[model samples]
Target: MQQTIAAPQRDLRPLLALVATAAIGVFAWLAVSTEFGHSLAAYDPAVTTWTVRMRHGLVTAVAWPLTHLGGTLGLTLLTLAVCALLLLRGRREHALVLAGAMIGSSSLTVLLKLVFARSRPAASLLLGEPASSWAFPSGHAFNTGVFAGVLAGFVLFSTTAPARKVLAAAAACAAIVLVGLSRIYLAYHWLTDVLAGWSIALAWLCVVGVIVLTVRRRPRMLPAGGGPRAPAAGSGRPRDQA
Candidate 1:
């Protein structure tokens, strides 16, 4: 006779929820401080000044394209393209998740901008045309961060190749960092503003992930007999599989 034991299952919902809560708290604090016209972080000016001083023709050339890519029009178009591709491939869940992220992030960004009414760094702006909207939380950073996170999550969850996962993770990280940096380098936003955007995106993604996982684990409806629907022949799975 051979002895056998099943591995214990671990639930990650609690951990994910905790992270989401913490990130939300951080963004709220930043928003409140900005609304009151007080600087929460002492280094905001120092970082902004350093980035302004470091701007050059070469880097500005690079940052210009990146800034546009992470802008409102660019991100909106990119999101629509990606969702269409996912839908065409029959990945309905993935498409829905990406769409929700885009809508949620955009709505929250607009609401916060209106409520906080923080002004952009007018004197430090390097663009040919100045940004006229409120800019406490950089929209470019928020949208790009959320989009990169969704892409990374899809790759990690759907792919089995370790090398591919590594590449995906690296690409996602690079996108987030470069986009955020472009905002700062162009002097359109403060460093703290970028931080708040990233924090909110993290919280939003975690919440969406939790909801999807919960729905996926929900048990199916019972048959008319009410005992349990039998598993298909040769399937060998439990009849009550969620």
Candidate 2:
């Protein structure tokens, strides 16, 4: 006789917990590393040179609009709007995951900037002046990475259609890269700052992805004979299983 196969039940709570823990650990490590600080300082010159090159005439004009369009306010608002739509569509779990990714990355950016207290470039900025805070990690870059990476992860793992998923992934990557480039082009941050931002954001996102995958791979409850077990008393059917 043939045996019946059932889908696996994922426990996302563990993955979320793991991502949160790893995020905190990485942040703490970065905070305490004097060597990382020096390393970040060394990467500044290359970033500055690239920024100058990209800000010349036409490039500056084009990048100005693109960069401004992808600003923190714009990205945040866009993310929130999309998240609302996702939640309405019964994707609350994904929305929450994305939101966590955004909040975690942004919080770390602010905290690290405060701790480092590194100064922004003294030379004239290509696009605008810096006033908000010190430079060590680029908030723009970090936010871009977190937002884009998380969005990409959701699309890649959750979407059924291959074409749409690929397109979404491409778009997410483009957005992240452009935002990082914009920071350098606008001279708002050192190359080192942007690099550090990218690294931390990517690392955090990787941790998130790993957790999500771990949860997705968990075994579902099944009958001893190997089929989906009936729900006990009040446990309704697994709601979309994320």
Candidate 3:
């Protein structure tokens, strides 16, 4: 009975991957077609007032440092740390998946940035801080989405414990949200850029996650309900009481 239920759930994994792929396709279409340009431009700078406060020092006290975690080098190190943890846990395959997903997402962001060739917010709006990167999908948002996503996936599915899953999920979601918010507050990314980043990152994560789960699934010899199994006849087994 457990196998019967689990089989269907396993089958649905591929379909979920397909859905994520479709989302990526839609985002790419909108990007090339410029369908989101107007809204992106209009919304991009609307938060300038909030970020351009005179006490910018207060903002820099922690947010700027925290945002670096999404940067290429920072995220690379963090991914390695998680992979190491997974390795120590004897989940070598999951470690590989997590590493591949993160590294692949980072590379994708770099390539996409070049392909889009969209300029970052103008220097004037950046409060005199220099930001010299092409921005369509924010790297911070993309990397954070992927990293946090994989962690949450692990917490939710890799364990039998429910309380840990809920706690980890909440914490992971909050941290990822802060990463995106930090990007915007620093005048480093437009709203739509972060949205697109998240969209694509999630799509890719679903793909990687499904592939990993499929590859790592172990064969089970028993049903979900725990039950006793009688031993085969043997030479020395005692007969039933007469």
lDDT per prediction?
0.84, 0.72, 0.75
Per-residue alpha-carbon lDDT of model 2 for 1-242, expressed as tens digits?
Answer: 44544466555556655665765565455444433655445656676876676556877777777666566687788789979999999988888888888878778878988988877776565467655787777788778888888877777776379998999889987887878787777777777666667767877887777666665565556556566555786777665564
Candidate 2: Cα lDDT at 50: 65
Best by TM-score: 1
**Winner by lDDT between candidate 2 and candidate 1:** 1
Candidate 1 Cα errors over 4 Å, as ranges: 1-10, 32-40, 222-242
How high a TM-score does candidate 2 get? 0.70
TM-score for candidate 1:
0.84
TM-score of 3: 0.79
Write the residue-wise lDDT of candidate 3 on 117-202 in tens digits.
Answer: 77676676663467677878888888888898888887787645898899888988787788887777777776667777888987
| Per-residue lDDT of model 1, residues 108-195, tens digit only | 8898788777777766355557887788788888889999899899998774798999999999989998999899888888887898
lDDT of 1 at 28: 87
- What value of lDDT does candidate 1 attain over all alpha carbons? 0.84
